[model samples]
Target: MLSTVLLRQLTDQVQELHTTAESQLQPLPLPVLNFKPTPGSWSALECLEHLNRYSRFYNAELTTALHAQPQTATPHEVGFSWLGRKSYDTVRPDNGKKHRTITHMNPAGSQLGTEALHEFLQHQKCLLEMLAAAQGTNLNRKAVRIEFFKLLKLRVGEALQFVVAHEQRHLQQALRAAHQATTAPILVV
Candidate 1:
């Protein structure tokens, strides 16, 4: 069970992230959304697609986890485990470290369309819904396992925070991709 204060804080962060991502990515044209800085880099659409994939997994997992746990009489605010805390810190945009993503989490390819943006926004909506659902649940219970390591589990609150931070990191990536796309020099074939 998470403290009301913590839940409020997390909710605020998720809302802010959703607003920023929507404002930045929702208005772009298809060409700009799909532009990659280079062959190896992700385009803005690719970034959103990658995030959407993770969001799909986490949203479902969180829903199931929330359903499985019963409400507790005395809910306390529990912090993350060491591993969970480390994982959450790693995904923050300020970390400045680029980690390699698991193959499954990577976007399929470039040439994506604005529908990716729509899906991304929908995922954000799901996240907000999940956050709202969590208010009455025991967020300190071991609810969800890490996607990469099924052996390890995180408290529900920790998992939500980690997911939000990951979203923030990728939103920053998408914004950077969009910025690069708009500024890049074009060459006629």
Candidate 2:
């Protein structure tokens, strides 16, 4: 779970990524980045496509969660430290966790075109807006998850941390995909 401070930090990072990544995203040389040396390899387009897919998923989850009342009280404040690293990269040992696979049900992700980036931006903005609404006591409230990972349910603060951490994980992947672009392709903001 995330503390209030952590949520704020994550929100700031999300905004930063929006600016930096957007500034770099352009479509003039799409085919170069789309090239795959091997059949199993992922191209830049596919990477962005997956991010867009999860962005939609998370957007729906956040919107659905907002309607439910917390079983407990909400929190208004928490503390965070620095924002000195890149996105939360799960594969990195410093990230302190084993990497997990992200599902890609749609094999046709590359064909989505510019709509993929637009979806990602829209979802990120929507997520930040929802996070804003959860300020005040909502931060401390007990969040209701359809399925709790452990015996006890996560508090709202914890949930936000999970959300931010998860987002940071994906954000890192999106950035990593940039490396795989054929000609240093930019992802459209």
- Estimate the overall C-alpha local distance difference test score of candidate 2: 0.53
> Looking at model 2, which ten-residue stretch has the lowest summed lDDT?
79-88
Candidate 2: segments with Cα more than 4 A from true spot: 1-3, 32-38, 70-110, 140-155, 182-189
Model 2 lDDT, residue 98, Cα: 48
Candidate 2: RMSD to truth: 7.1
* lDDT tens readout by residue for model 1, 36-124: 78888898888888888888888888989988876552457667788888989999888999999899888848457778788887887
lDDT of 1: 0.81
C-alpha TM-scores of all predictions: 0.90, 0.64
State the displacement of the C-alpha of residue 143, model 1, in Å, after optimal TM-score superposition: 1.4
Candidate 2 lDDT over 95-156, as tens digits, reads 75544444553333346465566666776688778766665445544443423233434454
Q: Which residue window of length 10 is worst by lDDT in model 1?
A: 69-78
Displacement of residue 100 (Cα, Å) in model 1 is 0.8
